[model samples]
Target: MQALVTVQHPAHVHFFRHAIGELEDRGHEVHVAALDKDVALSLLDAYDIDHTVLGTRSGSLVQVALSQATIEARLVQLARRLDPDVITAIGGLTAAHVGAALGIRSVVFTDTEHARLSNRLTFPFADEVWTPDCYWHDEGADHHRYPGFHELAYLHPDRFTPDPAVLERRGVDPDERFVVLRLTGWDAVHDIGDSGLDGLPGLVRQLESRGASVYVTAEGELPDALADRELTVEPSEIHHLLAYADLFVGESPTMATESAVLGTPAVYVHSQPLGYTDELADYGLLWGFHGDDRNARGAERALELLDAADTTDWDAHREQLLAAKVDTTDVVVERLLGDVGATGTARTATARADD
Candidate 1:
């Protein structure tokens, strides 16, 4: 099988990185078209996943639209030459457009129902829409729900193991009590009205007072107060830090979900509620603050957890979550290998070892 995968965000790279390798191992042709967004291209390089550049992601909705058009045009030309049997992506907008233009099957994998504009644009043209079972909406019969979160694709124990030496190598004690705080650049279409962490100085001070080393990772500019707190680790190494961290307080739902799946205490601050994040909260693996006072409420929750006497049993929660969910890479690779549709065996092969 020949597959074309489009990666728009850094998370998308993690989602497909393992699947790409697996497919190649089994005699498949895989091509990646990546957008120069944040650390996405850098991650592709670090993971040794060769890809063709598909323009850069820039500011403003208007610029984003124009860039999308240019990308779609380039994708059409590329698809004409490659003629991949299937095209897939996280949001799958450009892939859907180009697939429809070239009459190729486009498989869209998304867990975010709040991506209103992207979904409306991609779903109609996509041949298949793959979402987590926790996803809130139904896109009719074209939608296939799987029993796992997107983070499982790489973070699942079968594929990943936390490296504590990463901490000592970075000049930190392996057993040090540390917290990972993340901030996102709210430039995406869905994040227009949503908010992330505000008053970072105050929050950082409070986190420091909790007697843990603080690590801050942000997309855009950092406040002067947090300038010295920025984490200098590579994008790929963030997961290792997250796995060992005492707590994760972030505005990026992806990181929050990643932290939860890694059995770390997580607090997500966003005005919008995500089905997976909400479910993680239900499992007592994460706390989500999603109203107008999201920042203040989220900070309070983080502090309370840090100060709690009866601490959360993160390992137990993680084990419970693992018992119910599959390694999502199974689904991604199966779908790409033409083992999908109503008769797909991916759903039946949830046990990672079953493959």
Candidate 2:
């Protein structure tokens, strides 16, 4: 099979890197097209994935317009040249719009309710939509539903195991009680507002009170107050830290899930129109709350949970994650390949004017 992938975010790049590798290992011809997401491109280059460039960036209004125009031109050209058998992207709006116009099979994989906004609005025009069982969007038309999230597909023990070497290379001590805190850059599409250095000081005091070391990571601008705990390592290496951390706290939903799957107690505060956080809580691995609730008192509550946490139950949570495992990449690819074959036959018939 011949396939084309479009990635708009750094996370999508991570998804594609793993998905494309799996596709290629199964003898499929895969081509990736993406914007100039520095982190994404860095990971791609590091992994040596051959791909075409579509100059776009997920940023400011003016930058967004320019990137869209650039992507529009590049995508149009790519479709004509590649004449791809199938095109798949993770909620890739650019790809969906272009593929719909070309009458090509467009497959969108999404897990979050927020990411589905575009997909729900534009999905009727798409050839297929794939999402986890947890996704409950109202697409006007019927779409294929997959059994797993991207995290489970790639990070699932059956498919991929995160290597601790990433931590060793970053100078992280193998045996130390560390807590990972992810500070969000107050500039996302849906930021939960700022906690400033005040929140950090309190949290640090609590962690230090418990004889734990703090490590900070963030996608947004780093605050001067937390400079001492800054982790000077690659983004992917952060996972190794999470895998062994005593606790994980972040405003990032992605990091929250990563922590939960790694069997680390996670607290995702603020940051959004809540989506998977509640579902994750049901899994007995994560805790989440609104960042803006004045009376939320989640920090105090989290500290209490930490004090009463059962380390022996960590393995139980891992078992739950394993039981919920589904090879999402394989399932999504198979569905898309099936759609591509069906679309090809329909196109042939329509060309003969047999509609």
Candidate 3:
């Protein structure tokens, strides 16, 4: 089988990395096309996944449209040359477009219900759209609901084990209590009206006042006051760091879910409510807050969690979460390889014949 996997965000790389390797190990050919977003290319390089650069994101809607067109064209050309049996991506707008143009099957894995514009544009062209069972929105017949979050694709115990050496390499003492704070740039089309945590400097100061070491990871420019608190580590090593963290306070749902799945308690402060966030909170692995004063509430939750000594229960909670969810990587591999049924090639042929 020949497959093309597209990655637009750093998290997408993690979501698909193990699945791609499994496909290759099983004697299938996989090609990757990635956008130059954050640590995306770095991760593909670190994982030794060969790929071509699709494009980078733009700030404006008009520029984004142009960039999407350019990426779609390149993907189409690549698909024509590679003659892939299937194309897949996380929020795969380009793959959907290219696959439709080439009469190939495109499968999309997405979790964000708020990505209205991207979903509207990509769904019609996609052959299958898969989302976590906890996803809030419905996309009709073609949408397939799974029993797991995207982070489980890589962070599941079956696929990952946390390394304390990653902490040692970063000059962090494994015995010390530390908190990770992730700040995202609210610049995506879906994030136009959304807001993340406000007053990051104050938040860092508050965390420090509680005798916890704080590490900040920001997608946009950090406030000058909080610049010294920035976290620096290889992109591939982040999960390991997160796994050992005492707490995670962040605006990015992806990282929050990642931290929660790793057994670290996450306080997610964002304007929107995500299905996974609510579900993780239901399992006592995460806490979610919204509205204008969310930052303060999120900070308070972090402090409360930090003050608790019985955090060992987090592992038990995480075990429950793991038990309730499927290994997403296995699902992707099985679906792509047709272990359960027809492969994308068969679906593509049927679609072409219908036309």
Best by lDDT: 1
Q: Select the stronger candidate by TM-score from 2 and 3.
A: 3
Query: What's the C-alpha lDDT at position 260 in model 1?
Result: 93
Query: Quick one: how many clashes does candidate 2 have?
Result: 2
Expressed as tens digits, the lDDT of each residue in 48-146 for candidate 1 is: 999999898678899989988999999898999999999999989999989998999999999898999999999999988888888888787677778
User: What are the clashing pairs of model 2?
Assistant: 185-220, 270-291
* Candidate 3 deviant stretches above 4 angstroms: 341-355
lDDT of 2 by residue, 261-320 (tens): 777888877635334567677777777766456224556655765675544487687778
After superposing candidate 2, which stretches have Cα over 4 Å from the reference?
115-117, 186-198, 294-296, 309-312, 339-355
Summed backbone clashes in each candidate are 0, 2, 0
Report model 3's TM-score to 2 decimal places. Answer: 0.94
Per-residue lDDT for 152 in model 3?
92
lDDT of 3: 0.87
Worst 10 residues of 2 by lDDT: 346-355
RMSD, one per candidate, in order? 3.0, 5.9, 4.4
TM-score of every candidate: 0.95, 0.86, 0.94
